[model samples]
Target: MLNNNLTWKTSPCSHSEWSQSDLVRGSRILYSQQWTLITDSNDHKSIRTVLPPGPCVPVSGEVLSGLSGHQLLEIWDRHGLRKCLNLTALNKHGRVYDDAQFGCLSWSECENKLLYVAEKIKNTSIEKHDGESPCRKPQQDRSVYCEDWGESLTNKSVPVICVVNLQSGSISVLQGVPHDVSPGQALWAPSSQSVFLVGWYHEPFRLGLRFCSNQRLSGDNLSVSCPRLSPDGSTLFYLQGRVFGPHNQCLSLQQVHYLYLLVVFRLLCSGFPSSLIFFVFVVASSAGFYDLPDYGSWKLLTVQKDLMVVCCSSPNTPPTLRVGFLPSAGETVTWQTLQQPVMTFDFHWTVLDVTTPPEEDNTHYSGLDFGAVLVKPSRPPIEAKTPLVVFIHGGPHSQFPAEWNCTTAGLAKLGFAVLMVNYRGSTGFGQDSILSLIGQIGSQDVKDVQTAVRTALQRDIALDPNRLAVIGGSHGGFLSCHLVGQYPEFYRACAARNPVINAATLLGTSDIVDCVGIQYSYDQIPTAEALAAMLEKSPITHAAQIKAPVLLMLGGRDRRVSPHQGLELYKALKSRASPVRLLWFPEDGHSLSRVDTQADCFLNTVLWLHQHL
Candidate 1:
C-alpha cells in the first residue's frame, strides 16, 4: 500500500543556538583516580587523582573521537565482550538491536546539535483504502494479535534520526529522511548548522556514508566503517570494506569531502581534474592511501590538526597507540608512538603465506593466498622447540588480525607458539576472498587451514610438528575437528568449542541455520542435492578417520550453534571409544569462552593439551 500520510515533528524543546565551547565544558569533572573503601579499618580512605605513568589504552572497540576535549570510551567487561558489549552485557542483555554504532549516539562539535538515531513511530495515521491489503495497518498500530507481535511490530518499525539542542534542551526529529534509509553514525561537518555525515542502511542490508539529506557518496557494493570528516572538511578519512567482491583486504581512503555546494561551483567553473576524479573510478578496485605507512587493519581514532591518532597491536606486541601527522607536500609524516602495554609473555610474530599451488590438471586458478600470524616466545632457546597451538577464529568471515589477543598470548605463555589463521573466507581481505569459502566450507576452508599449518612447518616457524595441537570455536571449531578427522596423523590433540560437526543437522536446528546452509551449500534449507552437499561438507562425514584425542566445550544457551551439536560429536566420539571429554557451560551461549567461562575453558584446554600432547 502506497500511503503518503507520513509526518514528522520535534519533541519538547526550546529555541536556542549551540556553540563549541558548550561541548568542551562539562558539568562534572572527569577524574583519573580510582576510589576504594578501606573496609578493613572501618574508615574509608581516599587518594588524590594521579596520572598513570604508563600508556593509557582503550578497553575495547574503536576509540570514539569526540570533537571537543571529550572522548567516548568503551568500558570493557571482563566477561564476554564480543557477544553483548560492555554496559549491556554487564546488565544481562544480548542478541538485541545494536544502537551504539552509526550516529545513534553522537554529539556535534558545535555542541548545539546532538544527533541520535532510533526506532520510532511517525505521528500521522494512515487511512485504510479499499484496494489496500488487509495486512496493511495504520503506521503506528498499538494492536497486538495472537501474541505474534513480531510481524506487526516489524511492519511498523521505523528508524528515525532526532537532533537535540544542548542549550535549550529542544529535540527535533528531522523531516524528509525516508523510512527505507536507516540513518546512524551522524557526524557534524565543519562550519555546519545542519550538514553532517550520516551512515545510512538500505533494505536487504547495505551501509554507506551519505550527506544528512540522504544522498549516498559511495557505490552500493562498498561498506563504510568509521567515516570521519577532516578538520578542514576537504577529505573524509574512512576505512572502506567491500560488502561483496573477490578482494579480502580492506583499505583506508581519503575521499573528497563533498559539501555539495563546493562541488557544483568547482565542477562548473574549473571542471573535475585528473587527480580529483581518480577516486571516482578506483573505489571499486584495490585502494588505500599509498603514501602513508601501512598500519594493518587500522581504525582512524581521532584527527588533530595535521596529526591522526590510531591504536593498533600485533600478535607479538600488546595494545599500542600512535599519532602520525600527515606530511606537508613532499615531507614524510612523523609518527609519535606511545609506550605500548607489555604483556607477561614476550612474543615475536611473523606472517606465513599459505599460497595454494595450481591443480595437477592445470586449472586456470593461480591459487588464493591466505596468511596466518605465528607468535612465539622471544626466548631464543625455547622458541624453536615450543609446542604449537593453531588458533582459528569463528566467523570464518572474521579475520584473525595481526593484533594482540589475550587468548593466543596465554597459549604462548604456556609454552606454545600460537598461530592465528586468517583463512580464505576472512574479511579485511575484501568481499571476494571472504565469499571464497562460501560453498567450500569443508574442502577449501579446511585445506586453507591445513595449508597454513603446513606453510608454518615448511618455513620452520613451528620447528616441532609432532608437538602440535589445534583449537578453535564455531567455524574454527569445525576446522579443528575436521583436521583431526581428515588428517588423523597430523594433529596429536584437538579442542573444539561449540563446533559444527554436522551441517545437515545444524541447518534445521541452529538459529542462524540459513547462514550455514547458504555458506556451506550456497542454498537455503537444502532438500535434494543441496542436502547431500551439506552432509558431505560436515565434519561428521569423516568422523571415522579421527585418531587424535579431543576435548569439546559446549555452550548450553547457544542459539547460534546449539549445545546439542557439540553433544552429538561427544556421543559419536564416546561410542567410538576415542579419548574425548565434554565440558558444558550451562549458562553461556555460542561465545562460551568469552567471559564467565574463559577461565574454566583456558584451564581445561591447557590441561587437555598438556595431557595429550
Candidate 2:
C-alpha cells in the first residue's frame, strides 16, 4: 500500500527502470527486489502490487560510473521475471558508463536489444612471445597515458555505444563512432535500425565536465542531449543550447520535423520547457525557482503514455510523487496523489524578489533581478527576534529552486528563518543574468547576497540582524567565506562546504580550471595579471578581517575545490586566534552527498549555528 502519511524524515523513493511486456497488457515497474509491480485491479478503478518472475540480490554500492564497487547489466523476463541475461562477464569493455554526463540505458521496441554506454576496453594484452599469440595479462608493464573527462569522471575517459541481443546474449560494440568522440545518452531508433546518441568530442583535451559545461568541440556552436524519437519515428526532440558561458544555460527546445529530412524547428517560449518521453510542456515562471514557495522541485521520474509521474517538494515539505494524466489538446492536467509526506512541524515559505541598491554602481548587472526563497517557522518566539540563516546555492550558475532541501528545512524547523538567495549569475533568469557574473564573482555575488539579507531584514520586522548566519557549498561556500571576510561584522557565524578560498591557488590544483578562468574572464593560459585578478577576487584576500565564528566542512576526495582550499582558510583563521571548527569527510566528493556524511554535516551545522548564533 502507498504511504500517504509519510513523514519528512522518510526520503522519497524513486524508480529508474520501467518495462512493459509487449505480450502482456499490463505495466510492470521493477524495484531492485523485483517485487511490487503495480497492476490495475477492480477493472482500472484500483491499483495493486503483483509478484514478477523471481527474487534477485541487491546490486550494492555506488553504482554511478566513478564510484561503482560492482555493477551488473541484467535482463529479466517481464512476464515470469526469469533472469535472461547478465553482462557481468564483459569486464574487458571496462565499466558501464552510469555517470549523468555520459551514460545511456535504453531498450529497443522489440525488447530483444539493449543499448548502453560503457568505457572503451583497455589494452590488457601482454608483449607477444616468439610465435605466440597475444593473450590477456593483468600485470602489463607497458604504460599509456589517457586523458579523461576529469574530476568525478576520472574512470570514464572514452565511452562507446554497445548493444546486447538478449536472446543470443551476444554483446556487440557499435562501430563507426568517431574515435575522438565520446558517445552517450543513446537510444534506439523506432525501427531499431539505427542509434541516436550525443557524441561529445574531446579534441584538444578533456577538462572536468562534472561542474563545468563550457567545454566544446572546435567547430560545434551548440551542445545537445537526450534525443528521443516520436512514436511514429517521424520527429526527433532534444535539448540544445549555446556551447559556452554559464555552467548551465536555459536550454531551448528543438525538434526535427522530418527525421530523414532533418528539417529543424526551434520552439520559442518565454519560459523553459521540460521534455517527457512523448510530450513537451512549458514550465512557466517569472521567478527563478520552479513552482514557487509551495513546491520546491518537480522532477520527472518517468512518463508512461498518458500518465506522467512527477516528484514535487518545497523547503518546508518533503518530496512526494504524483501521477498526472496528460490532457489532450485543450484539457488541463489532472494529478493524482501517489505519495505524500506527513508534516511533523508547521512552516511557511515565500519568494522574495530583491533588487540591487539604487545608489550602488550596477554597471555590469544593471538590469538583472535576483531574489531569494524565505522559509520560516509558523510559531515565533514572543520575546526574542527570529534568527536568520542566509543560504546560498553552489554553481554560481545554479539556483535554489522551489524544492525540499534537508538543510534548509531543518534550519527552519530549528527556528531560523532561511533565505535562499538566487544571485545575478543564477540560471532560469535568462542568458543575460548568467553572463553578468562572467568577470565579477566574489564582489558582485557577495554584494547581491548582502543586499538580499538587508532587504529581508528591512521587510521582516521580527528578523534579528544580530543573529545573522550564512551557509553554502562550492561557489556558494566561496560566497559564505566572502560574506564573513569582506563584511566582518555582518554575519555572526558561517559554514562553508568545500569552498574556494583562493582562486589563484585553485587555478593550479582544481579540476575545473576552465570554471576558474571563465569566472574571472581570463584566457585559458595564465598570466601575471590574471593571477593578480584571481587573487584580488578571492575570499582569502580578506581572511584577515573575518571575525565570525566559522565551521569548515571539507571533503577530502573533492576535485572541484580541493580540500586544500578549506585547510588554507582554517589555518589562516586559527593563526589569528579566531573561533573555527573543521569537519572532514574523507570518502566524499564535492557534493558531500553520502548518507553518513550528510547526517554528520547537518548535525554539526545545527550545533554550530546554535553554538555561535
Candidate 3:
C-alpha cells in the first residue's frame, strides 16, 4: 500500500480580510511568525542551533540561530573564518589566505592531527612533513588528491576538478574526466565516507556521479542526486533516471534526426543487457513518449546491502519516489510510492523548498494581493538589521521556483536574506501570465517586485527598504539596472551580471532578433523610429540617473547579451561620474561555467554587495 496518509498543509494568512496591499503586508506578517525547521528523521544525528531572521548579520559573520542542512556541516567550528572560500582568480593570484593564521585547520580522528588546504607561490614545490608542520602526511603522493591544479588545467577549455594540499602546498590534477560534464557540487557521502561528485552534460542532459576513495574510483559508476548514505555506511540513498532533452544541439531537424537514430539504436542493441529484454521492450513501446519535450525525471535510488530506491517522475505526473531492491532483474523489482509529490522546475535549478503551500488564502499588498514564496536560507536567518538581497532571475520567461538555487543558498549562508521574485511574465503560473510580459518590461512586472519588497518591510518580515540590494543576471540584470535608475530610492546598490543594457542595441545585435521582434512587437513603426523609441526604455540610456554604486560583470564570449552591452553602460556611467566597477572573464562566455570563474563571480558579487550595501 502507498503511504498517501502523509499530511501536507498550506500556509495561513494572519489577516485574511484586508485590501490588496494590506493583504500582502499581512502575508509577510504571517511568514515572519512561522519558523523554518530542518528535520533529520534518522536518529543519532547531532543537533545544531538555527539563526534568527533579519539582515543585521555581516556577510562574513556566522550567526546560526535558524540555519539547517548538510551544507552547514563544520560551519560553527574553527573553520568558520574560512567559510567564504575565495575561489576567485584575483584572490588566488594575491595569495590572500597563504599564511597559516588565515588557513583552515581541522583535527582528523584518523590522522591524529590537522588537515587543510591552502595556497602558496605558483612555482614553489610543496614540501611534505617537515616535523610538527601543519601539513599532514606530506610524504604521501600529492596526486592522491582528486583536485586539479597548475596552469594546464586552469587554462583548459573545459571544466576540470583539482585537489590541493595546503599542508604541503602542493597541487595535483585529476584528468580523463569527460569534457561535456561540468561539476557543480561535491560532497563526501556520510555513510561511506566516499566523495560524491555530481555534474551535468549538455547534449542529452545526463548527470554523472562517481565514488572516489583515496583518490581512486570505487564501485561501479552510480548516477544519483540528493544522495544520502546509511548511518552505518552499508547503504546509499539517491534519485536516478530522468532523461532530459534529446540529442539536439539546437531546436533543428538535423539534431532531431540524429537523436531519433541514437534512441532507436540504443533500444535495439548495445543499450540493454540480455537479462532484461522484456522490460526494455515494454519501456520502448510506451505511447506519446517522444512527444514529451525533454522534461527530466528522477527516481529515488536507495543502495543498501542489496536494496535501492529508484524514484522517477514524468512531465505530466508528480514524482513517485520509488523504493526498489537490487540484484533482481529490472522488471522483477518491487515498488512503493513515497509521500511527497516531487515538482520539477528548470533543469539548472539547484535548491528547492516549498514555501507558501498551494492552497490560497486572502492576502494583499499595494492594491495587489498575491501568494508568495520566500526562499529561506539553508543557514539560519540573519539579524533584523542586515540587508536583504533580492535576486531577479533571468529568462524573463522563467519563474523563480523554490528549488536548489546555489546562488541564493550561498548568499543566505553569507547572511543575506534572499527572495527570488516570480513576477509577471514568468513561467509555471500558466501561459497567460507569461504572455502578459510580451511588451511590458517595466510595467506591472516591475510593480510585482516593488510590491513584494514593500510587503516584506511593512510586515517586519525582512530588511528595511533602505537596506536593499538588487542583483540579477541577463534579463534579470537588465531589471536590476532599470530598478536602480528608475526607482533610485528603492535600492541601495546594484550588481548586474551580463545584463541586456540596451534593448534597441540587443534587438539589432542579437542572433535571435527575428524571434524577439515577433515576441515584442513594435508600437510605432517608421522602422528606425520604432527602434529608436525602444531604445528609450533601455537601462543604458538612463545610466546617469542611477545614483547607487554598481558592479557589472560580463563574459568575453557572451554572444547572447554581447559584452558591448556591459561595456557601453560602464562607459556611460563613468562619463556621468557615477560609482561603477566592471569585471570581465576573457575565457568565459554568456555564463561562468568554470569552477574558478564561478568562484570569482560569487566572491566578487558578495564583496561588492558588502562594500556598497
Task: Identify the candidate with maximal lDDT.
Answer: 2
Candidates' TM-scores?
Answer: 0.65, 0.81, 0.44
Name the regions of candidate 2 deviating beyond 4 angstroms: 1-71, 78-81, 84-92, 126-145, 261-305, 328-331, 516-523
Candidate 1: regions farther than 4 A off: 1-103, 119-159, 170-182, 188-227, 233-300, 340-345, 360-365, 378-385, 427-432, 508-525, 557-559
**Which pairs of residues collide in candidate 2?**
6-342, 53-80, 53-81, 296-313, 296-402, 296-403, 297-402, 297-403
Clashes of each: 19, 8, 47
Which residue window of length 10 is worst by lDDT in model 1? Answer: 11-20
Which scores higher on TM-score, 2 or 3? 2
Superposition TM-score, candidate 2 onto the true structure: 0.81
Predictions in order: lDDT: 0.56, 0.70, 0.46
lDDT digits (tens) for residues 1-613 of candidate 1: 0001111122111111111111233222221211111111331111122123332222212323333433232323347432211222222111122333443455566645555544443233577544322233565653523111121122323444555454554445544444344445555445544334344434332221111111233456565555555445665566665443322244556465554423211112111111112122112121122354434445455443333445656665555444444555565644544334455345777777777755411132235677898888666444456678889888767777777677887777777788889877787666557555666678877888888888888787445788889999988999999999999999999999999988878776653323332532223356677677778888987788888999999987776676788888888888999889999888777777344477778889999999987
